[model samples]
Target: MRLFLLAAIAVLSTLRVAMADSAIGFKQTELPADAGGHALTISLWYPAAPLGKTETVGENAAFYGLEVQPDAPFLTGSRPLVLMSHGFGGSWRNLNWIAGALVRQGFVVAAPDHKGESFTEADATEIVPLWERPRDISRTLTALLDHDDLAGGIDRGRIAVIGHSLGGWTAMELAGARYSADLALKDCNRAKLPPQCKAPRLLGKVGIVGDGKADPRLAMDWRDARIRAVVALDLGPAAGFLPETLQQVEVPVLVLAAGVETPEIAAIKADSDYIARHLPGATTVYREIPDASHFSFMQICKPNGEKIVEELSPGEGFVCRDGGGRDRAALHAQISEAILDFLKVDMR
Candidate 1:
């Protein structure tokens, strides 16, 4: 019996090594100037022939990175495409962990760094006007479908989107949720303003309101019909979304909110619930992750990551924090499982 048990353990170890040998393919590409004249940097992760040397990608002193075969040949046959959007002030690396999980499940994930909102750059003009966010994803899809190497491997019919924070708002817009500057201003004017509305803006701006009716860009429809499914992670500025547009969304949406609520921010009920109420009951699903925080959706941090982050940039170490003592990897696994299950139902 002891010999048999030892043999079984050896076999399992070999299987694990085999699985690790098959690595995800990762590469970075640049897109031409978008409509707003901003160059977009995109990161793609997909199934590739297991041939190249595996190296750690997206790693920094503060965060752990995923081991992938960089620039490997694309795997044969078409596969589903998933576009990811990072939160404000974040880059494509924020969703790197989730991208790897999806790629392991036979998916092609593309994430673009929004011009001004990205970590590399910050411009009030581009950041203030949120309508441009959805357009970025749309342009990314169009460009990829005609690309030299990836266009043939993308299953355009099974395209979906995953976004966190402001990215979540972007996904909503792409899912047909229209923005209303007037509504947003009204919410900002209330006795208790939303955290985003209360925060000081760059360029000496106080709030997002400035002649809401006259500013046509504030209410433009930025919906992308090609997006079949959407997964929004703790989206904000929910008050700005027009109820009628939410009800009109034809694409399926899976809204996952953080279980732990922050005091300074509005409750999840006000944001996720408000949007869920207006969405078509048959197509929308809202789920809250227990013991997870807004930043929990980001990439996993290394041991002593918070200390390193604080040393580098004080008061910003909160990026490495999560609800309670929950393991970030466990949280990420749960989140990825939920997303894959949800997409499986809709991405058919």
Candidate 2:
């Protein structure tokens, strides 16, 4: 335990925020779900007074970054809006690094904690319907656009979204990729699907269940037209997408995948590779992090993560640890730069 503590401290020291020279605004606000089921909390990072102070996000079990004035007024100019979505079982805090980076780059970032799959909320009904993920984003967009304080500063015509793993799939759907049960079964199977894929499980709650093949309800349109482009990071559930609908996508897309062969990458490799080729979008780039893991795309673990892990469950800290001896902080820097570069050209 002595050695472990020392090692954990060293790892934490390496991620010392590198001391940002500029400040980006950050705030968390709850928005009522349009469905009126579960309320949604959105973590927003945008341009603000560049105070050099630092603050922890959430409980700091996951990450810590630049501090933002609480509910700071929007920066004086119009900026593209970038909606953020975390992976299943993750909170907006998962993408703090990316959100902070984008907000500094003059783009507004809002990440909604999908109630059922997020850190604080878990429910079979809210999480089971795959379509609900994109719908969450769509509803949030509407609310953001209508909010008196936010509407004027947003570039309604220039909207982009970034999401990791399950959120990556959500980004695709929001970017106009529809779901087709038949097309999905070709390369996806029940055994490989996540628990959220269990439609019967959700159907049973609503007193609706069909014969064994698949819940026909899975074949519905969840795409949101407001998303002009997307950056999908290590997406999962290859079978949930319909190629016919994916072919219909015409926006810019950047698909980043983890190169390592862990279960995380295994879960999304098919879908990532397929979208790289299938997103008929005029501009598309698929880049694999040579030695990175899927979770490496997320913020590095908090320095005290070891203690936090002891308090949480086993798989809780699994994504926090990356293989290949990669520096998680350094990786976040690179990924942030890569994404900003992509958005620079695509979003413009």
Candidate 3:
């Protein structure tokens, strides 16, 4: 009887491990570009049974891609495809926690390291040409959806996008479906910068053409892409085009704001509120995670990081001024669940 009890316990543990392992399969590939011989590294996370193969790709490449852990489990074939983009100076790995959680819930997540940005401080100044990065995303999607390996694995008709900071801005622009020139001009004036901006102007440009549209560029068309939903997290101050351009967005949007008390936070709120009020066919939801800082959503927080311990205390990760004694995993889980829930209603 003792031997039988022990055998049963061992079997249960093994089954649990096997169940977890069956959910996800991870792989990395370098996607070649047509222009200037440039290439982008893309990481693909997909649904798989416990018996699927798992391989490790080492060392997180900040400006490139990182492999998803082989042991992660994903619900098989019930979920849709999600494409994620990282914030400025963030590598594809910065959002691993979010990606991993999404995969576990059955999403096939594809994250690309933008052409020029990554995790290191040295690459901090290397912002990819604004429009170029979004184009990269579009192309990457084309590749993923068309690839032999992933062809039928994803539900192309039900796709969603999530971005952080700059990436958030990209997601918003993609959903707006069209651009407006007047909106760009207003963003420049708000920043108190001169109008009639030229190329590479970070402050006053009407679209992504110049310095990446702090004024918000509305000078182009979006080619009527089929993205069904968008979520932007912790985006910066208005560029000229956001207000006018946002009105053109035809799908639902959710904006998550951080650091409400700070000047930057205030600016972001203003922009977010403006979009919520004006965007057509858009239902916007805004929430603030108290004491959370700009970088809290990413994996940059140290053990005693200011934003980590105080604002989010007793929730996720260490204790600090932002929040104390917060569990990072729990916070991430909430974020992942929120995203999944949003997609379920909006993407369907």
Index of the highest-TM-score prediction = 1
Q: Where is model 3 more than 4 Å wrong at Cα?
A: 1-21, 35-37, 51-79, 120-124, 150-152, 177-218, 242-244, 259-266, 300-327
Q: Which candidate has the top score in lDDT? A: 1
Clashing pairs in 2: none
RMSD of each: 7.2, 9.4, 9.7
- Candidate 1 lDDT over 211-238, as tens digits, reads 4342566467888888888999887768
Ranking 1 against 3 by lDDT, winner: 1
Sequence-dependent TM-score of model 1: 0.87
State residue 11's C-alpha deviation in candidate 2, in Å: 39
Which residue pairs in candidate 1 have backbone atoms (N, alpha carbon, C) closer than 3 angstroms, thus clashing? Answer: none
Q: Where is the poorest 10-residue window by lDDT in model 2?
A: 1-10
Deviating ranges (above 4 Å) for candidate 2: 1-22, 35-37, 50-54, 59-62, 122-128, 186-217, 303-307
- List TM-score per model, in order: 0.87, 0.81, 0.70
Report lDDT (CA) for all predictions.
0.77, 0.69, 0.57
- Candidate 3 per-residue lDDT over residues 11-130, each given as its tens digit: 535544544654556766888777733577887777565654554342321211233446444443434677888876566666766776666655678888886576343554556655
